[model samples]
Target: MALTWIRTHDWDAGTWRNRSACRDTDPELFFPIGATGTALDQISAAKSICAQCTVTRECLEFALATNQEAGVWGATTEEERRKLRKSWLADEQAAAG
Candidate 1:
């Protein structure tokens, strides 16, 4: 499936954020400063929260749609999202063709 829903769906039209597992958690947990040591722990912790989230798909879609360049969203780190974004854009282009 595509990582983005922005093309056919309104990114801001849903209240899925209200149901996010990280809503009450520290926002900084998702935006670690580095990719190793403490940052890896933080990323793991954040992804754990995302793993239990019911809105994970929506969260990922929103992140991809908005080009979120930092933090963990939908159990994925920045690097993971970048790769997924590339594939998603490719899928979008292929579908358009």
Candidate 2:
């Protein structure tokens, strides 16, 4: 899939949030304390929901754009997003150049 970069100025475009699969779910499920045992379970559960979400890309883009340091967005864990954010930033820079 092609990456779509979202600007901070467009953070207000949150209409897709209402259409998210985890909207009604527990917010804590997405924000785990660690990446082991129970946290892993939480991540798995959150990802399952994301897997079924139509606005997952939008959610992930928002997380990446806003630099969300925690939680599972777009089916990715905190560590996962951190690595992806680096690549995302590189890609954005390259695109801008």
Candidate 3:
């Protein structure tokens, strides 16, 4: 049971398999990483693709639940979520201790 849409978006979603999407591989392809701005630009490109995805909500939930500390999930970048998760973990540890 394979979801075609998910597979198609797999490349744009920055999945481990998609790391090369922006990088040309074929001997015939000659693309350049010439986007304006800084690293935010890369995140923006990935987010733009995720925005139109049908499974954005599901992706977001999975990311938060698994404490995913990498990649962009939903509209949130890994760095942004990392700070939030770190704060939550610290609070939980303090409460438990």
lDDT of each: 0.85, 0.84, 0.50
Candidate 3: tens digits of C-alpha lDDT, residues 1-97: 1111222323335554333232333312111133345555666767766666665654654565567766667556766667655654565456558
List, residue by residue over 1-97, the lDDT tens digit for candidate 1.
4344555556567688899999999999999999999999999999999989998888887888789999998888889999899887777688688
Instruction: Tell me how far candidate 2 lies from the true structure as C-alpha RMSD in angstroms.
Output: 2.3
Predicted candidate 2 versus true structure: per-residue lDDT over 59-96, tens digit per residue = 88788878989899988887888888888888878867
- The list of candidate 1 runs beyond 4 A from truth reads 1-7
The most accurate candidate by TM-score is: 1
lDDT of 2 at 55: 85
Root-mean-square deviation per candidate: 2.4, 2.3, 10.8
Provide TM-scores for the models.
Answer: 0.86, 0.86, 0.46
TM-score of 2: 0.86
Error of 2 at 46 (Å): 0.5
Worst 10 residues of 2 by lDDT: 1-10
Query: What is the Cα-based TM-score of model 1?
Result: 0.86
